[model samples]
Target: MLYDYPEYYETAFSFRNIEEESRFLTKCINRFSKIDVKNVFEIACGNAPHAGLLQEMGYSYHGLDINRNMLDYAAYLWKDLPNKVNLHEASMVDFKYPIKQDFAYVMLGSLYLNDFDEIVSHFNSMSNLLNSGGLYFLDWCIQFGDPLAHNNNNRFVIEKDGIEVESEFNIKLLDQEQQMYEEVWTIKINDRGRRKQFNMVERNKAILPDQFLRFIKERDDFEFIGWWKDWNLDNPIEDENNVTRPIALIRKR
Candidate 1:
C-alpha cells in the first residue's frame, strides 16, 4: 500500500499547504480551546508532516499510527528538532497515553470506525486521553451532502520532485440501516522509471449531520460545539448546502 511507503505517501499528498493548515490549527486553539493548550496529538498521524511545524510553534507534538515506517520517517525528518515528536503505535479507535493531550485533531476524513459501538469507543478513548476542556477538531468526517455522490472528480494525479501519484476513490453503500459505506482507494505511482500500485479497501460508518449531533448529545463526556465549511468559522453549516470541507469541533465535558 502507499501507506507502507512514507516517501511516496507524502509525495502523493504534497498538494496540501502545510503552513496554511498549521495556521488554521493555531487559530482553532486560540479561538475555541477552553484550556491552556500546551501540547497536541494527531490521530492516525501518518508521517506526521506537521510535527516540525508544531514544534517550531512552541507546542509539544505527539502522534499515533499503526505503521512503523511512517513513524520512523516522521522521526527521521524531525530528528534534529529541539523537542522530539513522540509517536505511539496503535489504532485510532482505542488507545491510552501516559501524558494527556490538550488538543486533538484528525485530518482528511480519516476516522475509520465502522459502527456506532466503535464510534462510542473512539470517543471514550478520546475522553480518557484529553482534559476536561480539551477540543477535538474533526475534518470531513461527516457525510453532510448526498453520501452516494461519489462519481464526480474522484480521480486525481499529484506529482512532486520526480514522483507521480495517480489516485482514485470510490464509495459504495454497504448497509443502509446502519449507514455504512465501503471505500476503495487505488493508487498508481511512478518514481522516475519504476511503476507501482496499491489498493486499500475499508468499511466506515457514515456519520451524518443529524446522527453526529444526536450521538454527541447522548454522550456525557462531550458537547457539540459546531461545524463549519471551508475551515471558516463564519461559514457555519446549517443545512448542509455548501458542505465543502466540513469541520466539526466538540469539547470534553
Candidate 2:
C-alpha cells in the first residue's frame, strides 16, 4: 500500500473548504478547551490541508503519517512555512512527541485502528502527547440508510494548468461482517498530446460510532465531550437525517 500518488489523491478528494473547516475547529477549541492552544498535532495526516489553516491561525503544526511519500508531498506543499510546519514519518499507534500539545485531531475518518486493543493503544498514545486540558477530535462515517447501498461507480474530472485529469471510481462492499470495503480508481491524465493511465485499489474498514464511543469511554485517559452530526456544532448526533459523518470531541483527563 504505497501512498506515493499524492497528486491523484488530492485530485480525487476535495480539500478546498479547508478555511471553513479550520474556522469550525477554532470554534470547537474555544468551546471545549479550557487552556490556551498554541501547538497542534495531527495523526495520519495525509497531505495536510488542515495544517495550512492551523498555521495561518498562529499554531505550530506537527503532523505524523505512516506513509513516507505522503510526508514528502506534505513537506513540498508546506515548504514556504518551514518555521511553522513540521512533518514526521510515524505510525498513529506508536508515535511520540518531545513536547505536549494543546490540541490534536484526525479528520476524514482516518483513525483506522481495526481492533479494540489497537484503539486503546492509539488513544493512550494521544493522551500521553497532550497536556492536561488538551483536546482530541476525530470523525466517523455512519451509514444512515443501508450499509450495502454504497456500491456504485463515480467519475470526476479536474483541470489544472491546461491539463485535464479524469478519475473513475469503482466501489464495492467486500465484507459486511468485517466492515470492509474496496475501491478501485482508474485515473487518466491528458497533457497536450501525452496521455497516462494509472489504477489503484484502496481498502478500508468502517468503524461504527457506538463502537468508537465505547472504546473511548473504556479508556480513562479521555473524557467524552459529546459529538455533533456533520460540521454543525449546534446539531446533535441523534439527528441522523443531516449527518453522514459524526464528529467526536474528547478532552484529556
TM-scores of all predicted structures: 0.97, 0.85
lDDT of each: 0.88, 0.76
lDDT of 1 by residue, 1-253 (tens): 6778999999888989898888888888899899988889999899998888888898999999888888888888889999778999998888888998999999988898978878988998999999989999998898887666865678999999999999988988888899888888899989998999999897888888988999999889999998988888788888755375799999998
Q: What C-alpha RMSD separates each model from the true structure?
A: 1.1, 2.7
Question: What tens digits encode model 2's per-residue C-alpha lDDT throughout 12-85?
Answer: 56535788878888889999997899998888888987887788888889898989889888988988874757
Question: RMSD to the native, candidate 2?
Answer: 2.7
Backbone clashes for every candidate come to 0, 0
